[model samples]
Target: MAWDPAVYSAFAQPRLRPALDLMARIEPADAARVVDLGCGTGNVTRLLKERWAAADVVGVDSSPEMLATARGDGGGVRYLQADAAAWAENGGAVDILFSNAALHWLGDHRTLFPRLLGRVRPGGVLAVQMPHNHYAASHAVMAEAAAAGPWSEVLSPLAARFPVGEPSFYYDLLAGGSSHLDIWETEYLHVLEGDNPVVAWTRGTALRPLMDAVDGAWATGFLAEYARRIQAAYPPRPDGRTLFPFRRLFMVARKG
Candidate 1:
C-alpha cells in the first residue's frame, strides 16, 4: 500500500502520542548509533534524534516520497531510502533499532523479529510499535465490505495478509533473545470530527490495499460501502466528534 504523508499526518498529535509513549519506556543509556526503521516523513525520527542527541540517528524508509519530505529538515539526522526488512545490512551494529508503525508492512514476525534482534549489539535495544487495530471494527467492516460487495471476486485475496500478531505471540517468540522485555497494548480513544472520521483514519492506512487494487470507480464504490459500515459502527457524539478507539502494540527488548 502506498503511503500518503499528508494523509497519515492528518491527525499528527494523536499519531505522535503513541510514539512518545513508546519512547518514554526506553531505558536511558549511551547510544552511539540509532536507527528509525520505516520512519515515515521522519517526524518520530526527529524525536529520536532529540532524545539521543549524541547518537548518530539515521531515519530509514523505503518510500522516496516520504524520504523526500524527511530529508527536507531533520536537524543533522540523515534520511535515506532502504528496504525496512533488510535495514540492518545498510548500517553496522546499532545501539538502538527503533521502528514505529512500520515493521508490520513487511512480512511475518516469526523470522523477522529474530533477524532484527541479531542487528542489535549484545546490550542494545530493539524497540517497535505497530497497529493492532486489525481486529477492530474499522478493519473488520472493510474486510466485510470487500467480501460481500460487487468487488468481492477481485478483492478477497487482499484481505489475506494480516501483519500484526497478538502480544502473547511476541512474548513467546522473543523469550530466548531478550533479557528485559517490556510488552504492552494501549487502546487510544481518539476524539475526531467531521463525517465518518473512522473512514478518513483508515484511508491513510488500512483501507489503502483495496483502493490500490481497484480502479477509481470501483474503489469509490468500495469506499462508499466501507464508509457506510464504519459510520454505523462508530456514531458521532452530541458535540459532533467521533471517538475512534485504536489499539496498538509496543515492545522493547534488551538483547541478552
Candidate 2:
C-alpha cells in the first residue's frame, strides 16, 4: 500500500510522543551502527542520528513516498528502500535496532522478535513501539463498518488480522534472548480538534489498506458509513475537542 506523508504527518505531534517516550528509555551509549527499521518518513530516524551522533544511522522503509520525504530532510542519514521484514532478516547486525510505530504490521512475532533480538550485537539494544489499540473503538468501528457494507467482500480480508499481541506475549518472546528487557504499555488520551478526527487519524494508518482496495462510488459510500459510525463512537467533548485514547506497546531489550 502507498503511504501519504501529508496524511500520516497530519498528527505528527501525537504520533511522535510514543517514539519520544520509547527513546527516553533506551540506555545504549556510543553505538556504532544504528538502523531505524521501518522508519517511515525518517522523522524519528533523524532524532536517532542526533542521539547517536557518532553512529552510522540508516533509515529503512518500503514506501518510496515516505523515503522521498525522509531523504528530502537530509540529516546525514542514509535511507534504504526495502521490505521491513526482509531487512529485519538480512540487515547486518547493529549496535541499535530501533523501530517506532512499525513491526506490528507484520505477523508471526513469535519468530520475529527473537530473530530481531539476534540481529543486535552483544550488549546492543533492540527497541520498538507499536499501536496496541486493536480492541479500542477506533479500530473496532472500522471492522464494523467494513462488514456492514457492499465493500465488505474486498475490505473484510484486510481487516481480518490485527498483528499486535499483548504485553505478556512479547515479554515471553524476548525474555530469553536479552540480558535486560523492559516492556510496558501506555495509553495516551490525545485531544484532537476538528470534525471526525478519528477517521482522519485512521486514514493515515489502519484505514489506508481498505481505502486502497476500492474506488468510485463504493469508496465514497464506505467512507461515509465509517465516518458516521466513528463520529458516534468518539463524540466531541463539551469543549469541542475529541479525546482519543490510543494505547501503545513499548519494549527495550539489550541482547546478552
Candidate 3:
C-alpha cells in the first residue's frame, strides 16, 4: 500500500510519543550498529542516530514514497528499500534493532519475533513499539464501514484482522532467547483538533488499504459512511477537542 508522508506527518508529534516512551526504557550500553526497521519517513530514525551518534544507523522501509521523503532529509543515515522481515532475515546482526510504530504491519509473530531476536548479538537489544488499538473504535469501525457499503465485496475482504496479539503472547515467544525482557502497554488519550480528526488519523495508517482498493462513487460513499459512524463513536467534547485513546505495545528484549 502507498503511504502519504504528509498525512502521516500531520499527527507527527502524537506518533512520535510512543517511540520516545519505548526508547526511554531501553538500556543499551553502547550501540555500535542500529537498524531502524520500518523506519517510515526516517523521522524517528534520525532521533535514533542522535541517541547513538557514534553508531552506524540505517533506516529500512518498503514504501518508495516514504523512503523518498526520508532520503530528502538524509541526516547522514543510510536508507534501505526493503521489507522489515526480509531485512531482519538478511541484514546481518546489529547491537540495537529498534522499530517504532512498525512490526504490527507484519504478521506471524511466532516466527518474526524470534528471527528478530536472533539477529541481535549477545547483550544487544531488540526494541520495538507497535500500535495495539486494533479493537478500539477508531479501527473497529473500519470493519463496520467496510461491511455497510456497496463496496462491501471489495472492502470486506480487505478488512484488517487484529495483528498485534496480547502482551503475554510476545513474552512467551521471546522468553527463551532473551536474557532480559520487558513488555508493556500504554494507552494515550490524544486531544485532537479539527473535524473528524480520528478519521483523518486512520486515513494515514489503517484506512489506507481499503481506500486504495476502490474509486469512483463507491469509494467516496464508503469514506463518507465511515466518517459518519466515527463522528458518532468519538463525538467532540464540550471544548471541541476529540479524545482519541490509542493503545500501543512496547517490547525490549536483550540477547543472553
Candidate 4:
C-alpha cells in the first residue's frame, strides 16, 4: 500500500519526538558516514546532517512516494530509495545506522538485528525504534476486523504476521554482539481532538494492510468496524478528546 505523507504527518511533533529521543541517547562521535534507515519524509533525517555536519548522511526508504517527499524537504541531505529488509546488502557500511519507527515493518528479528549491526563499522551505532502496540486494544481490533467478513481471505497474510518481537527478544538477539545495548519501552497517551481521532491516527500506520486488501467501499466498511471497536475500547473524555495510548520499543546498540 502507498503511504500518504500528509496523513502520516498529521501529528508530526508527537511522531518526531521518538526520533529525537532515540538520537539523544546515541554516543557523541564524529561519524564520517551516517545513514537513516526507513527515513520517511526526512524530518528526522535532517537532524543527522545537523548533528554531524561533516558526515555524508543519506536517508534510505522503501517507499518511492515517501522518498519523493523526503527529497523535496531534505535540505541537501541525500535520499535513497531501497528496500529496508535488504539494508545490509543494498546499503554499505556506515559510522552510524539509525532507524526511527520503521524497522517493525520488516520481520525476522532473530537475524535482522545482527545483520543491521554488521552494516555499521566498529564502535558505530545501530539505533532503532518500533511500535510495540500489536497486542494493544486498537491493533487487536484490527486483527479481529481482518478475520471477519468478505475481506478475510485477502487480508489473511497481513493478519497472520507481526513485524516486531518482544523487548527481551531484542536484548537477547543483540547483547552477544553489541558493546553497548540499550533497550526500553515507552507508552505515550496522546490526547487527540477530532472525530474518531484514534481511527485517524491509525489510518496513517496500522490501517494500511486492511486498506490495501479491499476495495474502497469494502475498506470503508472495514474501517467502520475497526472504528466502532476502537471507540468502545477508548471512550472520549469530558472535553471530547480521545486518549490513544501507544507503546513503542527502542534499541540503541553499538557494535564492538
lDDT of each: 0.87, 0.93, 0.92, 0.87
Q: What is the lDDT of candidate 1?
A: 0.87
Write candidate 4's Cα lDDT for 1-256 as tens digits. 7999999999898898889999999989889999999999999999989998999999999888888988888576998888888876657889999999998888777878889988889999999999988888888888887777678787756766677988899898899889989999999888898988888888899888678768887788777888888889888999998888999999999998
Which regions of candidate 1 deviate over 4 angstroms? Answer: none
lDDT of 1 by residue, 30-133 (tens): 89999999998999999899989999999999888788888887577998788987775446689999999988887768888888888899899999999988
lDDT of 3 by residue, 62-116 (tens): 9999999999997889999999989878989899999998898897989999999
- Candidate 4: global Cα-lDDT? 0.87
Q: Of models 1 and 3, which has the larger TM-score?
A: 3
Candidates in order, TM-scores: namely 0.96, 0.98, 0.98, 0.96
- Regions more than 4 Å wrong, model 4: none
Task: Give the per-residue lDDT of model 2 (tens digit) for 22-67.
Answer: 9999985779999999999999999999999999999999999999
Lowest summed lDDT across 10 adjacent residues in model 3 is found at: 156-165
Model 3 spans with C-alpha error above 4 angstroms: none
What's the CA error at residue 195 for candidate 2, in Å? Answer: 0.9
Q: In candidate 2, which residue pairs clash?
A: none
Winner on TM-score between 2 and 4 is 2
Residue pairs with backbone atoms closer than 3 Å in model 1 (clashes): none
